[model samples]
Target chain A: MKRISCDSSSIIALSSNCLMWVLDKFETEFIIPFYVKKEIIDTPLKGKKYSFEAMKHGLLIGNTLKVKETDPILRDKIIKLSNTLLSHKGKPIEIIQYGEADAIALAIKEDVSTLLVDEKNTRLLIEDLEGLKKVIERRTGRDFEINKTSAQELNKLLKGLKIIRSTELIAVAIKRGFFDWPYPRADIVKNALTALKFSGCAISSKEINETVDILTQTH
Target chain B: MKFALDALNFFKKTDTKLLRNLSDKILIDGFIEKNNELINLSIVVHSLSKICEKDYYKKDGVYWKTFVDKIQANLEEVASDKAQVIILEKIIVELDNHFGRYKNNVLHRSKIRKGSTLYAWGVSLTLASQMVKIPEIELMKQIGRTKIVDEEAQIKTISERLKDAEEIL
Candidate 1:
């Protein structure tokens, strides 16, 4: 079974779409860092409505979703790497939260197949080199010349890691007969993906439409 | 420091009207006592920085840069004391760097702790409301942080709670 580590945003996105239960249908083992669990559980209890819903969904998943603690040394290393990777114009950017750092560290330490996240910024950092450069340019207002060493370092850290969003999970669930709605197959897939988008999956309309088409055709 | 504390107290109350009145008092008194506009600006900046944990500048860097530039230009013309001017310039640079760090971190999608993010946002909203002399509640609603609850839809009868409890039990 593939191992998947999830950040809080993806969990919240899944919860918002009422699709958190679909994780049980997969053979994949889901893990969340201790901090990510705290993010889902504690923050919401403080009156964040969205977080509260996510916590409820988390509880519904129960033991299927493993809450793991990243090795402290590995967690610190990943945090340092994340901060270094995000710096622009030779200045360190302190943006990665403890939960995100812990999630990434756990994935790396445990050799998880994928890290599930729904934040646009994080996705770009891991997947889009050009997009990362554009973000640097926007933030610093300077031409971001990608240095060779930095590129190599980032590639090394992120190599062999797959980053997925909640939309993809929903698509998979649709393919696996997890959703038993009476709607047309195409409509069901489209609506499910679209709901994930509106629920903060950071997926574009075009992507959702394309995914819907692909899922229907594949079926 | 007293000014900063007073500003924070007013911010916590979400009293934009009182903050505006206080700003007027600070400006007048600061100018009369110190003959320095930087002092007045510093009071406001100190309060804003303290409350927002300096997240306000990060959220809107260009606006803050422009604001600091305007103050710097004004200080050059009005203040004859070079030492005071230099000190104010350092403050401006520090504020600029503070916001710059935030902007970079966010762009990189580096995680910021949930609690800090919420606190920063809350403080930023309060400071913006006070700066604009608008009610914080109005700003909160405008920002989609607060919503008009439908009383009828939200009402849960005692029977419903009992039924839920019974089902759980």
Candidate 2:
């Protein structure tokens, strides 16, 4: 089974869409950090009933979706790194939360296959293609090609960790027959991606359209 | 202790006059004493950002919004000072990104998955302060997470608490 660690946003996104039940069907082991679990399960807030219920359902799923505690030393290091991680403008802004820091730490320590997160800042900090472009532009005052050298540098910075969003998960779920409906296959996939977007998946419309195109073609 | 107390009090009332006075005192002290003003400026900007955001949603008034903009303008002017430009620009950019995150109801939708605006703001400030070398405990205390007298209590690690939370499964 593919081992995956998730942040709170992805979990809530999956749960809010009523597609969390398909998590087990995908043959992936979902691991959540303790802080992420508390964000969803322990603390109950108004206007967040869907996330609360999703967390309850996640708990009911048992070992397949385990909640793991991060190693203290690793967590501290990740927190420090995340705090020091500069933005596109090279400012040391602490954008990642404890839960995100813990999730990344657990992934690094345990060697998880992927980390599921939906926050834009964390995503940009990790991959940062646009940010890399901006950096280049700021330094040279001109556009530069994103060649292998720049890509390698970014990969090294991100530590070669595979990051996926809830939108991609939804795409995979649709591919695996989790979103079968009476409507046309294209419509079903489009609607599924749109639903994820509306539920705060942080996917762009262009990405959604591309994912829909690929899924439809594969089908 | 006084600075921490004043900061804590500022969060409660979110008075602009209080913030202005505090920033002025810190700036002057930093200039005369040759101490770093980056941390203090970051804290002030962070607090102002939160207050402006809260008022944006709560009162829907133009007063707080314009006041925050004016403060940013003033900060930009201060940034023109040769020595302070870089750090102050970083702080201003961070503040801009912080507000930009909620642009166009994106954060409004995400609030369902994340916690309320209050919770998000609290966490952001806590982490941002940590980046600036402010103690997390102090920020938490200022945010009313811990009582003033209980400041010496050891905060439990998340992993240690998770050991007990495992029983929830």
Candidate 3:
């Protein structure tokens, strides 16, 4: 069976109406990390559709992926190193050693697992994982590989649902109260639609127009 | 990991001198580097756009109505008008917390000068009044008159004073 690991970012991006449609088309098994599961069900999810409901019915596979916490010592090391590096500027050392760190550590232990993470952090994270594999291969004569799916690709899956249009996803998100305004709604809409289109969902222009109307009225 | 508390310290009273000691290159570059997340960058850009929106909403005379509706929907409170008002107030506070720094921009500067409470009041009262079928002129007159000398009052005027705060669509 083909195994894929998913995180909170993937689920959040996939929740778009259009993107969710495309994701429904996939039959592959997707894994969820323990921390990511916690984030999805937490209080902040109070009224969201993806709230504990997304998992209660087994839409997302929450059991297959492993959980890994940061080693206290290693975490301390990153902090200490960052503190010194940042001391001159008198800036606070805000080294994030948990979220991605846990994901990376768990991925290493899973052995050749494909991770689904946001694109901005992917390059740096993959490089770190590759470096670890290199060190281990040199010492133990063994190697492992990893792959990924970006937020954009996961979004395109929404179009497959065919219930909404890619362009209307942002309006839906806002109307659904997924995001508050005082931010660029257009940009948000663009980002949401980009994700759906990239996810491989096909949508018609007419559908986009209808969605815009619904969103305008409701939002 | 950098906690909010750590960032808070950088703004201490004594840091007045320290701020000058630090170069713009060091501080600005460090901030961008640390917040390289797409969401973080998006937040900055989004906040900038809202000011312009607030302006649009103000002009159409539907600013308060839309703002209250959004808050009510978010909190899932359909029956309680008071609850809706309270939630709208909180939402305004939250928006300020996130984008308060940009209050001086051409778009939000007017809102800030008018104050957050006034802005909230304008939006809430105007929106509430409209839903209840109150005439626009009456709603404006009623909301326009207030002696609640507090930050909330200031916030109310912030949205009202906008050049075009009522262009929802």
Candidate 4:
């Protein structure tokens, strides 16, 4: 079976807006790293407010998503390289947690090419070196330098690893007739995409308008 | 030196609004300096500022002291530099004890709230989470609730990402 790997945050984004059900609509198997399972299902289950949302995700894990064990050695290397890839004030900026790193490692280990991730930093670190440099500068009001060795090593590992957010997933799902939009209003797809953004999918207004344009125009 | 004293003074005064400047300072300095201690201090001040400003009773003197007095005692014992991280960790325990019902990691909510405020200030999600040591997932959820991403430009076009999703499916 074909598979796509996703981290916990994407699931959190999907579950936040009632879009987790769309996972079942695809022929592809949605797999998560073991650590990703702990992040989405085990850890959040203990919190008061998030416990209920966590339980909902637990059901999706059991019924729809498959859990796969990742290579710990590979996962750690990714974490170490990624956290040290960018530098600030003569110190390496630590980015990408074990959960995000483990998710990427599982994809590499399993030969999965597409990763569904909603966190902006992980995507930026993987796809945009200069964009990330500007973010660091803008946020800190200071300049930062990058460690080229770590950057090359990280790029070698993440080469050809395609990243997409939950917003895009919903757009694709809607394009393919996700069951949720039945008896749809003209604005349903746009609304659904917008809802995912407001629910923390890290989508921009321009992207949302553009997505709405493509999806609605073709619909 | 000055930050620690201001934190102490912020606690001493009835006005929680003073936290805005202190928080702005830490947010900028914490990222530029790449300092964990400043980041920890940032989380504490930002969380207290939000909590006090939003909640009615927390703004009042006696009720405010209930929270501040405890942070103050811990502040008194430590050197100014170390006081920030210590007080942050202590507040997690204090809040858990105060609520008395939820399991641990409840303060994940509070920690991520402060983390999102950093995101609003134009820091990347990973940088903000890394600074405060919160998970990306937790911080992402807070970002959704706050909808701060609406302000920033999207790095990739939506149509381009749609193709990626379609290819995977």
Candidate 5:
């Protein structure tokens, strides 16, 4: 079966928006590694505010989304590569961590070409390193020493991995009629995408409008 | 660590200005030493300085003195060892015990804020989330609401990513 490795950000966003049902309906398998399970399910289960949401996520793994194990060695290598890719004032800026690396490793292990994630860091690193450099420099207003060697190595490992955020995921789903929101007459796609943006999907106003424009054009 | 002693002296003087400076120093030390406790402490200390600087935190009666006394006692007595996650949770909890005005769980909110600060300083979302022990979703929203993680800086167009999402699953 075809598979897409998923990280915690996408899962949490989907769960918050009551969109986990789409995982079960899609023909492609969504794999969540053990470390991601610990993040989105186990850890949150022990917390106060999002425990119930974590339970809802746990149920998804049990019933629909498959839980898989990742290569710990690969995960550690990716984390080191990502963190060491840039330096600030002679210190290596610690970038990506365990949860994101776990999904990357799982996708590499499974030979999957795509990763489902919402956060920008790992995605920007994979999609465009130069772009990420510009973004970081613009944000911090400080010069970061980019280790070209480390960037090349990390890019070699992460080559061809595509990122799909929850906003895009839901937009496609709504366009495909996946999100069955009850209020039928409401602009379901637009409304759902807006909710996703506010609820932690890392989408911009322009991106939201662009997506809504394309997705709603057929309607 | 000298930070412990610095924290102690600041507690004695109750100097909100110096405390804010100390917080900045501790945050820089956090990046250098990879110390989670120091980062959390820096956040809470920042919060404490903000609180102390404001007149709103002042109480009219002896209750204010008691509140200050209580905070001073708690902070002064925090041993250098075993200062892992306790600094963040403990300080926030102590404040909650005294100030019933906060609308939300200050500890949780601080963690998200800390994660945002770290991300804006060039830490990855996942790394910042892991350091502050917050869900990436929460931290992402916190940072997303800010202009620090500028979307326009990204190279790919939204439609390209949208096409990938539409085609993949």
Candidate 6:
């Protein structure tokens, strides 16, 4: 079976008003890293208990799926990738480390045709991994690779779903370094959210705006 | 951040109006059913207080103590059940003490820029879900928020209202 594995980065994008469209575009076995589950519990789904109901239906298939632990070899590969990215970027590769990398390694281990990843720089990092490089080169006859799409493509896909408002998509896009820079990107997302009317759901524009403002003003 | 506080204040003022615009039956029955509104309000206040107490900038620019007191006062004034208000106050205090122990030692303004909005939304919605019994912790284990993806199913269930609008208008 041609499997499809996802990093948490993709999962975050998919669950938040983007699921409907992404699923429409890509359908296959989705695997998440065990660390992804830990990270989810640490944040995002922090207080909401409904995640259980969502998980029951296989929103994320990790704990139930039999995944080989990070063998010493894979661990060394990840550590090297981390160090190389850290050396190059001067800051750590934030999202695509730890469990996320494990997910990519697993996908390659499974010989999956497609790996759904969302972070921008993951491709570059994966280029340095020997095992994955061999697979990518053999598969593409050029290089073994981590497949990816940009935040922009994800936003465009969301727009197509009409699940979230275009303005909101643009805002998220801008926030994720989508809009170029300087201007408050969340403003774009807010406008998009307002435009979508968000299914007439009783959304707290006030709270969202406030949080974004706080984020902008302080940071 | 400035905007978030202003927005919160705006929401507080308009909160009653929101409950007001609904039909009298809803206000009297639905909003009051099993003290759902009261529970929701208490949870919101509790979470706000928690945020205020925990935020790093909270001590520098924000008045955590004053803000929390105001929310407490508002709950008392608006609460239909006086006893619940007192009980909720104690719980909030207890929570404050408990959470305070794990306070972040180094919260730099610089790192704030790197925060994830999806993570923020997830945390907020998770708290809201937990209060309503939908629970984000369990949801976190799942790949997505399946049960409440519609959102309308849990928090803002209004299919009946939509049907009413279609029929009457």
Give TM-scores for every candidate, taking all chains together and pairing residue i with residue i: 0.56, 0.53, 0.34, 0.83, 0.85, 0.33
Ranking by DockQ: 5, 4, 2, 1, 3, 6
Error of 5 at B19 (Å): 6.3
> What's model 1's lDDT at B150?
12
lDDT, candidate 5, A20-63, per-residue tens:
87777677889988988988878878878779878877777856
Off by over 4 Å in 6: A18-27, A41-72, A85-96, A127-219, B1-112, B116-169
As for lDDT, the candidate ahead, 2 or 6, is: 2
The best candidate in terms of lDDT? 5
> What DockQ class does candidate 2 belong to?
incorrect
Each model's DockQ score: 0.04, 0.06, 0.03, 0.46, 0.48, 0.02
DockQ of 5: 0.48
Question: i-RMS values of the candidates, in order?
Answer: 16.0, 14.9, 22.2, 3.0, 2.3, 19.5
At residue B30, candidate 6 shows an lDDT of: 18
lDDT of 6 by residue, B4-32 (tens): 23324533554433322221222122112
* CAPRI-style docking class of model 4 based on DockQ: acceptable
Sorted by lDDT (best first), the order is 5, 4, 1, 2, 6, 3
Q: Which of 3 and 6 is the better model by DockQ?
A: 3
**Model 4, residue A22: displacement in angstroms?**
1.0
TM-score-better candidate, 1 vs 4: 4
**Higher-DockQ candidate of 1 and 3:** 1
- Show where candidate 1 strays beyond 4 Å: A48-58, A86-89, A138-140, A145-150, B1-169
Q: Candidate 1 residues A81-138, lDDT tens each?
A: 5545534345544435466667878988898757887655455556665565564454
- For model 6, give the RMSD to the true fold: 20.8
How would you order the candidates by TM-score, starting with the best? 5, 4, 1, 2, 3, 6
TM-score of chain A of each: 0.88, 0.79, 0.41, 0.94, 0.93, 0.43
Residue A178, model 2: Cα distance from true site in angstroms: 2.3
TM-score pick, better of 1 and 5: 5
